[model samples]
Target: ILEQCYNLMDFEAVAKNTMKKTAWAYYSSGADDEITMRENHSAFHKIWFRPRILVDVEKIDFSTTMLGTKCDIPFYVTATALGKLGNPEGEVVLTRAAKKHNVVQMIPTLASCSFDEIMDAAEGDQVQWMQLYVNKDRAITKKIVQHAESRGCKGLFITVDAPQLGRREKDMRSKFTDVGSSVQNGDSTDNSQGAARAISSFIDPALSWKDIPWFQSITKMPIILKGVQRVEDVIRAIEAGVQGVVLSNHGGRQLDFARSGVEVLAEVMPVLRERNWEDRIEIYIDGGVRRATDIIKALCLGAKGVGIGRPFLYSMSAYGQPGVDRAMQLLKDEMEMNMRLIGCSSVDQLNPTLVDTRGLSMHTTGVPSDTLGLSIYDPLVN
Candidate 1:
């Protein structure tokens, strides 16, 4: 059954069928009208690739370093909380798959398994990063960061986009309505607030630039600000002395109509180059990245790497660890094939000339058609 799934979108269709209604809603829904959610994927189509041919395409290399850590691929798994909603093993399934693939997994603060437990599940020398949803209490935040550092988490990815959870209408509707009958009863904990609100309630809304120094003082881990939507913020993140920035809109889950990460990357790259901060801080992006070609587009626009969230969750939901492993392998296969076709033998050979970005920043009305992602929105079966 798993072999029939050829791409990440196929996994979503299978996961939608396999998961409970509420779980599917929680994983798939974006803020308000989901305009930005659809835009994130559609934005990639606007950029046309200019692949070179007949340039000795043998020996394509996709391996690169993310924040100084060697990764076998150019992309890594972005953090998604409440993994138990998808599978019995939750984040641990991801850990095993990432370890097997030699890619980094950013453990969420609200993971079904505790931080230490996920670390314990890792094999020796498997690099992991911590994604922090800062608590309202400073003491709690301090303890969590310190603990993650002690446990060998290589970097700190601070989620700065969400001070409060956006109104994900599907999750909200699921919370008020009952879809529990169709959901499989796994080992997931029951929450009165449902998946979206339950884990996000403790997030510190007061998080601001002032907190960067406090975080710096607490841990020696490299800091990368996630959810930076503007070039201005990217400049602020660099001046604040952080190691990196993730150009993301929080998977379009927060802030309706916020620009896609790839769009933001296009706006930020030139400024970074002019300021000569390109090498000083690594830039990464997440959202609507389903294809290997999408990764190539972001890389050409100067993203160090890209992050994939929902596809991995869907893969885990449909086939557990093996599903996640297959998903990674598929991406690796695509990257190798695409790179060779683009006449690039290595990830470093990619540049802005490889793509046309004229339509990227233009915003259009209505949700663009995505049959695979839209499959999850069908009325739940009871």
Candidate 2:
């Protein structure tokens, strides 16, 4: 174990150095020109904290509840697919780490490990949520949902974005570079999606608000729409009668120029407050959650909790289970220090007043997409 992985970004460098290039491209690649992916991280720079003093800051509690579940922290291990590519132990490693931290883990539908394998890895009544890419086959989707509920899953995060997987050219380039072996599935196996989207091609493009009730009928788990982008869609989500909605752009994997999750959170919360609908549903945002302050900003903007995906995968990829354990601990430490410095004693004390989102919506740096530069670029250094 390297003792110097001081923060989340440190893990990225480790993972990049540790993992194979093909796996790195798949794990790191965003949609189209990856404009939104970069923006997701950069947007957090816009929000500034309003710290207070002359108050009791001796103790700080960062624990919070989401979708009627208690979590040790306000961040969940958001779903990411094909964990085996990162480490041979696959998603089960993440499951054990989440259980240890008492943090919720949202299991991806396209996980390298089977649903049973991932759930079986859990100890006791460890809460895990399901991330569904609604299949075209309604029966198959229903069976998957109901089975998840039967196996003690608490929440259903239906991915409302990514009807079709975006063309990640870097990932595609890996396929082109590979001299595939015939013993596996033959030369005509159609390796266009490489391994990441191997099992993800069945996502139904026609999923809409009308299908919410159909999902409700099949399972009793709290239904959370995972890719809601705008305030209007959030209002529609409330009208659709779901239990929660995640403000995500599919981790900047589905759309090219879509707004970052925190940026959208700033837009959504004020409306929820105006309509007095903040209590109607739980709201979560994933993407660009690289640090504790980013998580704090999202919490201040009325997000129930933020989801962190890539960093854990990077840590797990580079150092396995121990890496993930340390990654979670680092965030917990940062949260305590930052919350105390900002004069916050608990997660509930975090509000819109704690942070200024005035610059959150502004895109000051217009980064023109340079294909070759992006190909060799190291975003972790930034």
Candidate 3:
């Protein structure tokens, strides 16, 4: 029954009502009209599935690697700040569940759990990645990097796009300002206040592409830049020696009018091929990835793996760590089930050929043909 409900509740329901109106607005609201946000999911709807029948499936393996670290599934939870906003234990719950599921869980600098505490919670599972905001003060940013290294965090993911947080109308309309109220960061017990301070210190208004080298100089742990949407930035990331790039529109929480991460994947992949860096680095993404088939589509489209954010939070909010475990398990199970149905046995086998993109148009409005647009197998139209 829990599993059924989990599958039935889309991303919105998991977020609705549980979060205070203000926090919900902020976290759920995309940039402008949320055109890109809608498109991200809409684009997925445009692809049709062509599942091959008659495949033997006595056993299946959903395990794969990201930055060479083996994991139980092809997707991992992205680091989002203020878990306490959803549950009291906050980051601790997420870390424990992630460890149990054998997946990487990145911790935001604004994480409610102190870096050391969260690290300890992982119980020697160093698959955790630390997200650095790369604030104005290099000293502070470098210190956080060192802290992550000392805590055994496996990698550093620098969010390059947000110099200043975007204006989310939903949050504005929520008519409240307490996005982070449960956990304390500095002298304040208010998570929202702490979040404000954290972002203020680390979000350097002058941050630029050149600054990535400075981060590279400070730590040898692989650096992954999140929020990459354009091909030029992808090229720049490769030139900067980034180990990976998450093609994201900040989960449609950043740019409302921006292109969906899925739409951008098409543009980014060819440039990546041109760079001939496909063999040298990893390219992963997460946006509108609500089902097992969504994971398969991302992989087929050229993502090395996918990151899950809001959905995991929804699980955590609904049932704490157990619920999170269930969510992760369901995703892995769905991936396995979908893989068998499609006549593929592993994560690496999915590609453009597995799904059809014909006659599919994506936007905020409804798709031209639901089957044509969203099927794993391309739809045939006469």
Top lDDT hit: 1
Per residue, candidate 2 scores C-alpha lDDT tens digits across 219-286 of 88999999888677777788788999899988788788889998888767766776688999999999
Whole-structure CA lDDT of model 2: 0.83
User: What lDDT is reached at residue 193 by model 2?
Assistant: 61
- Whole-model Cα lDDT of every candidate shown, in order: 0.85, 0.83, 0.72
Question: RMSD, each candidate, Å?
Answer: 8.6, 8.0, 6.5
Q: Model 3 off-target regions past 4 Å?
A: 1-4, 8-15, 53-55, 175-202, 359-382
How does each model score on TM-score? 0.91, 0.91, 0.86
Q: After superposition, which runs of candidate 2 have C-alpha atoms over 4 Å from their true positions?
A: 176-189, 363-382
lDDT of 3 by residue, 47-164 (tens): 7877666767657787889988998888888877677777778888988888888989988777777777888888765498888777566887888898888777788888876766
List candidate 1 segments past 4 Å from native: 176-193, 363-382
Clashes of each: 0, 0, 23
State the TM-score for model 1: 0.91
